[model samples]
Target: MRPIAILSVLAGLSALTSPAASAQDRPPRPPAFASPEVTAEKKVSFRIHAPKAEKVQLSSSDLPDAGRGLDMTKSDEGVWEATVGPVVPGAYRYSFNVDGLAVIDPRNPATSEANNNTFSLVYVPGSETSDAKDVPHGAVAEVVYPSQTLQRPRRMHVYTPPGYEKGEGRFPVFYLLHGATDSDASWSTIGRAGFILDNLIAAGKARPMIVVMPAGHTGPFRFGGAGGVSFETQMAQFEQDFVKDLKPYIETNYRVIADREHRAIAGLSMGGAQTLNVAFGHLDEYGAVGVFSSGVFGITGGPNGGAPDTRWEDAHKSTLDDAELKKGLRLVWFGCGKDDFLLKTSQATVEMLKRHQIDVVSRDTVGGHTWLNWRDYLVEFAPLLFQGK
Candidate 1:
């Protein structure tokens, strides 16, 4: 080899054998830390490491004064923290705002999502009924079935009891639903349905039954109206898809007691309206109905829902007074928060039903339109279903 070529070969060999190429070139890892350390007193403390950020805050709908963000104080090491609440027991969605950017706790893996955003989840475990306990847990399944009405496949979440696969007998079903902008997964995740049901079933408070959580947003829905697809049109379409499509699919696929007396339906917010549309209109399908924090929208005092030419009452007047519906329904349950924006609408709904000589159970709670109340409502509602059978 030529002298220059020999030198070049030696340089290549030295570079190949160098420690920098093997190990020293790797970047340093960040310091170890843990977030969301809950104190023994049940206070939730949130932490984040953002060295360059000027401001950080903790945001959560579950907080008592969430409108004013929980201000976090930064340490000399750039770790920011804020502690609040002897908070109520349930799963609450939270996000860390670092210098105006909303982000999840990087140190935490538990999370939940909304239609437009994502959030980290924290469980404050004190409640006997809502907390995930050491019990025979059920299985929650994501099911996709054909929607012949809309010409596409739709998704739903179905929760089967602990021994559903091994058991030979069938179980009654309760159809639960989510509010607007939330998907079918809401009940399983932040809503904590699985845990609640597991504990309830194990404790013999609720019967071992299947819970079906279906997506409620079937069409264009916003605060105002969509261009052509109005709320009534969308709700009507949902009613059709639900009664005609999803019910049949669930009945044929699952091991269910396939009759009205064994089936019930319930929902919150937008879902509450959907529940009314499905259960009230199709009286022969469901024996019990639960409406939480909602009623017919477009009523004058309804929550942010704009005025429609005809409210839900104007449309469902005949159906509400139907003898088959009155006779077939085992229980008509209505629960609304005292501070909920839709309290008046719920009140109107109950009053209207009562005028027609229909019996309804109206429950008034202490919170606003939120998951805190919904969780409690579910615990109370689940035990009441299929009791007459």
Candidate 2:
């Protein structure tokens, strides 16, 4: 090397080793590891390096006293730490509340999304149905189609079963729906629909099929809120889009069996109600209906905490009484948690249907209004679909 170049290189090396460079230029090396250290027992240890924050708390769907928040203590180095749970084996969402500000765990990359917010995800493996298993995986696609009814383009998440890209035959379609605050993306992400279906199909518990998760929130919806594009109005608009645009687009674009006997409709929470309205509105199009933790709005009775509204039943009296038309349906399934706020809603709906002589299967499990029950419902319900009985 030339003497000038050698001197310049030496000067740079000297600067890098200088005290000033070590103090200001080189950043503090990151910790050996980061937040969300999961133990074998499923207890999770979480940490955040925040020196300025006076308070930090852990908030998770599965944590004990979640509504009350789990306190996180600070260390000498200003890092906040907390450990919680033998967290149940499933996917969960968690966030750190730093002095009232909600923040996703920076150390965790896996995330679950909702219509209005996002949360960090952690998987507590060992679940038979919901966990990642040694099975053939399916493909989840996000595609958009023009909504002729709404005069706009809309998006949806479609899960084609394993080998669909290479397969040569048509498959049955399950129109899966999400909750009021969830977009079309919820099923494949937080709900883990793809993995659950893959596990089910691989284990011979379910037939391979297409699962379509559409955007159910056509407009704003807040439970117990008065006026301004109520959920009922949004449901009507969604029904129109589903029937006129979304359904036909899927049938044309994908390999779907275009018959009522090969189609099923189901959803959770807001989506469950949508399932009822859309499927019942066109009973000739769907062979099966699955309701998870939901009932007709305002028509809820018992523990739903209000005077039971029978106006909906009174309005649909003729249809409910038409047992002949509904007989064409192969299955009418309903599931709710024992502690779910909508337990009464599910019960009243099932009782009303039974009164009309409709054959309905009701399942009561242990859980509240959450995905724990929804995922379980899907695993239990998917096997019954497209069974040529």
Candidate 3:
């Protein structure tokens, strides 16, 4: 062996056996991956490395108190880390408070799936939809219809029942409404209305019926307007827009059952008021009505309470009266959470209907007026439609 080569080999071996090794003598090891697990019953830890930041904080909407705010400490390579304790999962919306500016976790790629800027979800154990298996589900689509009332084209979304696009069978239709400060996209985006219906239809709980979601806000109120003042006029305009323009377009474009017996209407909050004003008043058009949270009449029976005083005929001059409601209406189903701001209004509407000998299926829950409550209401309500022979 050459003396130089032998000496080099001996030095390398000596370095391995010695307490310290030369700078070039050691080989690099691979980086380590983080293995973190969480359960629904217990809390989970989350760590983020952001070493250069001056201050870091964590905030979550689900937590009663502000989330654990971490002051990041620098590592050898100038990386900062923030660690927080276990949190109950179920799609927790959280953001990092970096220097007082809220930010989503850049290291986490899953938050990108939602396409939301300020919020991210953490799926905990035992979520109903999270736990459910992939089954045959319905489809949702965005569609545009011509509107003569607004003097422009209108856009809306529809969720077709399972086997609808493929099969030759005709299906019933339900026209759903969204609340104020929300658009036609609200139901599909936040509520997951299509997914909920798909699950129900797959389980045979709901009939194969087409679901339509429409924007109920009209005029300046659409952008942002207060109730009691702009609501009546705006609501009236919405009714006209729905009946004169939207309805005809849907009938022409889709293979929907056009008769009143095959059509229904429902909504949440401001949309709920629209549901009652439009569906009940125009019972000749919509056979069934689902009223959630908001109602057309308040308990006081005054002009702004919920329903009109004296009689509904005087309040809604052109629409049908109570006697007509009894003749044309098939079902009036209403639900609201006990803690909802609109609870009293919903109760008053129910009493007014019942007093006029109108039958109703009323339900109440314990949640505040929130999307989670509404989603569950839909999960329950979808099955009740088109049940009778």
**Top-lDDT candidate index:** 2
Q: Give model 3's TM-score versus the native structure.
A: 0.70
Which regions of candidate 3 are displaced past 4 Å? 1-132, 219-233, 297-313, 316-325
**Separate clash counts for every candidate:** 0, 0, 10
Against the reference, the lDDT scores of all candidates come to 0.85, 0.87, 0.69
Supply the TM-score for candidate 1. 0.89
Q: Please give each candidate's TM-score.
A: 0.89, 0.90, 0.70
How does candidate 3 score on lDDT? 0.69
Error of 3 at 291 (Å): 1.0
lDDT of 3 by residue, 1-389 (tens): 99999999999899777855554576443233231235345454444455456766666644324445545445554444444445432344456677777777654554411211435444445545423348877778889888889888787889887677785878889988888666787677556688777777777787888888886766445333443327667777888999898878888778788887788888998888888778766677877889888776444565454444545535654444357645767778889999887787788778766766778899999876766577777777777777763
- What's the best-to-worst order under TM-score? 2, 1, 3
Pairs that collide in candidate 3 are: 43-86, 44-86, 50-80, 51-79, 51-80, 296-306, 297-306, 297-307, 298-305, 298-306
User: Root-mean-square deviation of each candidate, in angstroms?
Assistant: 3.2, 3.7, 9.3
By summed lDDT, which 10 consecutive residues of candidate 1 come out lowest?
Answer: 301-310
Ranking by lDDT: 2, 1, 3
